[model samples]
Target chain A: MVDIPILMIGKNVVVPIQTELNDIGAKKMQEDVLYKIEKTTASGLVIDVSAVSIIDSFLGRILVDTSKMAKLMGTESVIVGMKKEVVLTLIQLGLRMENLNTALNLEDGLNLLRKLQETLHGKISG
Target chain B: MEKYQDSRDSGQGQSVSTTIFVASYEDVIVARQKVRELMNEMKFSLLDQTRVVTAVSELSRNIIVHAGKGEMTIIKYDESGRRGFRCIFEDKGPGIADIDLAMREGYSTTNSLGLGLSGSKKLCKNFSIQSTRGKGTRIEIAEWK
Candidate 1:
């Protein structure tokens, strides 16, 4: 129920939050994803939150926490393809998401992730 | 003379139109209807109307279930270029200590979805709350256009 594995499409990485990422699920997923990103040192992570429609204050706070987790592990997390209704809900809740990266769609998100990875690769190789 | 009388009476009518309410558990649905009608009179958009209704439902339910009793106030505001309403919910209940913890997802003090305060916050343009342990709590929510 918690800690689903990160998916790899070529070099792009995706983590889908399928249900309500409440207390226990959020904590467990944060640990697992942080570990995976640190181990792979992935260039970018696309968090697919499309499955989650209603994100309460707790879920929103945990999301902010998870993003921080990714940053500490040297991976950039980008949230992709949020429903407009959900966005409106989040804005209403005063859920501060200023620290997270948000993308409009999956392809655009993947492109951006790929770009980040390429840039990181160049820096390391150079 | 007729126009003068109409203006004076119309002004009085407008004041009467804007009435505040404090709803009990049984009165929450009616209270929500009143808020919806208020929004309609203000010509707020559909989304704004829905937001206010949703926020009202969540907050009112919280007052009933968590605090056992509470009071709600509806006031009109047009201070800024925008015009809308300000709703205040006050209750003498088990106050929220860890506001931050309470704000987190999945953290519910009751059997409810635990999304009451947070959801209410999201439903309005301006959301604020103040609470003390065993003292009481006050929530303010506003929607403007």
Candidate 2:
């Protein structure tokens, strides 16, 4: 099954990938997240994957796709709490997923989002 | 691509290696769960456990999508003072012709940009593939601790 939880954290959307998600589940997640991002006008998306044990290249691609969708909708996507083994496997798979930003944990992700927002605001006359 | 030392000989007489049928998606999930349990009992780190589980998922899925129906075995191995788990996937489906080509990165038979074979090889410490034109394919992967 591909069920995961998406919650609101201030103006951000926090997605916790607590289990192995199949392709169907991830596609649904992308739709739900994009809808919420537009409706709430959120500024950041932090995907917590500390609990995820297995991630295939296909799932890795979906994460990159979600980040692209969020970026287009004015939300910065940040993946947080990736396990060390997961990182090693991802590298071994030779799939350097483009446009996906990551942090150490949820707290770090939030800080990163805030800093990016501040920079955007400071640079864009808003 | 590379096959290393096998520790199966030390298993007294017979090991209760589990054979899983891969005729549908449900079987893949069952195999993943079983592999996770074996890894957990072996006290593999979360990352190592996940790596093996991910490889299992990929191989099992390939059996279903590429081949019609196949089987896999999960057995615990202890070779050369290293203890870990090994998974063997076998299919009687149409086998791969060019192993060298299949092992290349960025190559796919179907359009999902399928990571296909090479990715799985990279995820494990020991990997080997044997295939015949119309006979079948056998893939073995092992990670030692």
TM-score of chain B of each: 0.79, 0.85
**Candidate 1, residue B80: lDDT:** 38
TM value for model 2: 0.84
Q: Once superposed on the true structure, which residue ranges of model 2 sit more than 4 Å away at CA?
A: B1-12, B77-85, B143-145
TM-score of each: 0.51, 0.84
Q: Candidate 1: lDDT of B48?
A: 68
Per-residue lDDT tens digits for candidate 1, residues B1-145, read 0011112243333212232334354455555667777888888865666567767766766777678777777766543364677777888998889888876644688754467776676567788999998987888887776
Q: For residues B10-100, write the lDDT of model 2, one tens digit per residue.
A: 4554334667888877687778888899888888888777777888888888888879789888777544576776799999988999989
**Any idea how many clashes model 2 has?**
0
Model 1 bad stretches (over 4 Å): A1-5, A122-126, B1-93, B96-145
Model 2: share of true interface contacts reproduced: 0.62
DockQ, all models: 0.10, 0.49
Model 2 chain B poorest 10 in a row by lDDT: B1-10
